[model samples]
Target chain A: MRPVVPYVTAALLFGLGVYGVLRRRNAVLVLMAVELMLNAVNLILVTADTTARAVLPHSGQVFALFVIVLAAAEIGVGLAIVLQLYRLRSTVAVDDVALTEPPVSAQPVGRDVEAGR
Target chain B: MTGADLLLLALGAVAVGAGVLVVSTKHLVRAGLYLVVCLGALAGDYLVLGAELVAWVQVLIYVGAVVVLLLFAVMLTRAPIGASDDLDRPGWPAALIGGGAGLGLSVLLVDAYRWSTVTMPGAGTAERLGEQIFRSWVLPFEVLSVLLLSALVGAVVLSRPDIGQPAPQRGDTAGDTSTPQTVGADGVRR
Candidate 1:
């Protein structure tokens, strides 16, 4: 098999991931884009395993496995964070999620942070 | 081109196409579904490249766990189910950057390979991969396990907001909060 096919594929995938990450507003969608980039990297590593000479056998695949593990952990924790964000802020848009605390007047809904206290 | 090359090319096309749909589609759930298609096609590419174990692992972890987790987050966030126009920022910038990156990399890779054929490697059977992992890669493997443990604990802690915060206002299945103007804001509006 010509190795360039997979290499170019990985490249385009990574590019798409970059677009998704930058374009998507939702945090979950951003995470999905991040997954795309990770997958593209994994594809490159696995392709390199077959094409490039390496000292350790299956090293590319091993790194791919590690990448997979990392991705799994990432998604789990990422979802937790997203869900939590939804809980507190009631939205998951990357832009809408302000880094600094909003003024008390800007609180969207009547949460009554003081309710029942 | 051999059958394997053709298969790889076809699967690559599927992956790239679905990836486009994943980022472009307006339907919130459909994007997740498109991701499944894209990832599955990549798995096929892996099989064609002789990484048998990696292919299956891709299917198992990426297709199974990660996509599921994404869908759950989508639903949990109450993301708009059908099409909403404003899921993305202005298209030109993303398109320009993504296109530049993809085309440049493609040009470089194509130039490097330049129609050179490669001998396919031995199939990465589970047994051989396991041996390599346990023998030479044992330390990283153990460390990865620790990372996974910490991630799990951290996810649990992060999800359960009551852990650190002084007041526990609501549960994980967040409801009762009327989320106004959440559509253009780009997420769920409860």
Candidate 2:
């Protein structure tokens, strides 16, 4: 039971994150899932850090700190982009705003056209 | 199980539950709020793991800054605050893919390191962490800072309002008291 608690928590968090990314349609939720995944990784790092405090040094915690900062910046910019999409589409559902190809227009010409063209 | 183990189980349950709610709930704002809960639980887990500095930073950066920014964006975008019944896409494939990947990774990880505790040094403190970040990781840290600065500049450039006319504030009782309308697709009020 030494590291069991942290291990279970990390696994659960990772699983939930997967579920979020899979099932959530809102782009915001997707971003949140990504954050959850990152935090799960952090938990593992901290657990390992605790176990190896005497040998491997503080690199684990330091790496986790860097990750936190990176996650902040990523969320800030990501939400801004999502906000932009919402303003244009009036909805945040990820599938609603996809544009595969631009519409094109051209003159129509056909052999079965009316009269002589 | 010890007290620490019980605490870990509790935090894990909360985090997983909140994460499920975050995705399954129809209200987007609630989802963002749930993320706060999930991250908080994660911070608690970090504390239990003895990474106190990392734990606090998790609270500060994720719960304090990231989620707040997300909420602000949700508010500014005027995303529906209530349950939305819109079914966007066929999500089963993505779910299957993600779930499969997670399962595979979990199995691999468990198989590779099953309850094998290998404790290294400086796991709980920040002294060596500071040294590492300043020494070996200095270049990457500086690069990350520059990247953040550029992102900030880009956000301003892309989303700044370009409204042609100025309007009275909502608090001005002499005029219409309606809140300012967000202007464009880019979060600019124009």
Candidate 3:
């Protein structure tokens, strides 16, 4: 099998993920996009490992396994955060969660005035 | 191209196409399903590359556990099962960027390794992989386990904030809206 084929495929997959992350407003979907990107990287790693001329052939597979594990942990924490955000705001839209400022009326007037200085 | 080459090309096509669907599909459930397809095809690609252990692990972890977790989260979050109008912004900019990146990377790769072919190594068996994991890769594996444990605990804590807090009482206070309490038939907060 030609290595360039898989390489091109991984590149396209990563691009799709970047698009999803940048354009999708839903936080859960964004997480899914990130998963896509990680999977692309895994493909590249396994491909390189398969084609490597080294004595030990399992390094690429091992690295791919680590990436998979990390992706699992990432999705777990990400989903938990999304669930909590939904509970607090009743929406999973990324635009709704404003990290820069508190929700209107939720912040005390005195605290807002203190920050104004 | 040989039969193996053809199979690899087919699998790669399926993987990339499903990956695109994963990010572009409007239905959340369908998106998860596409992710499964994408991951499954990638596993097939690994099998074609003679990495049996990694292929199965890909199937077991990504398709079985991770996508299931995502689906559960989707249901738990009450995401719209159908096409969600509020889930996306303008598509033109994202499409442009994604296409540009894909084209650029493909061009770079082809330019760097135009006709180079690397011979396939021997298949990575389960025993060899296990030895490597327990010996040279031991530290990173153990650290990953710890990370998984912490992620489990953290997810539980984040999802259930009222785990250690005292249950609300009828006369406690009317101003506490932070906690979501359920009232039982006996008029006590559960």
Top-lDDT structure, candidate number: 1
TM-score of each: 0.87, 0.77, 0.85
> Candidate 2: where is the Cα deviation over 4 Å?
A51-56, A101-117, B117-123, B161-190
Model 1: per-residue lDDT, tens digit, A11-114? 99999999999899988888989999999999999999998888878899989999999999988888888887787778888898788877773332334432
Worst 10 residues of 2 chain B by lDDT: B181-190
Model 1: docking quality category:
medium
For model 1, what is the error of residue A70's alpha carbon versus the real structure, in angstroms, after optimal superposition?
Answer: 0.4
Cα DockQ of the candidate 1 complex: 0.65
Candidate 1 wrong stretches, greater than 4 Å: A103-117, B166-190
lDDT of 2: 0.69
Q: Score the docking of each candidate (DockQ).
A: 0.65, 0.27, 0.43
True contacts kept of each: 0.83, 0.52, 0.70
Give the lDDT of residue B29 in candidate 2: 83
- CAPRI rating of model 2: acceptable
lDDT of 3 at B57: 92
TM-score for chain A in each prediction: 0.86, 0.78, 0.83
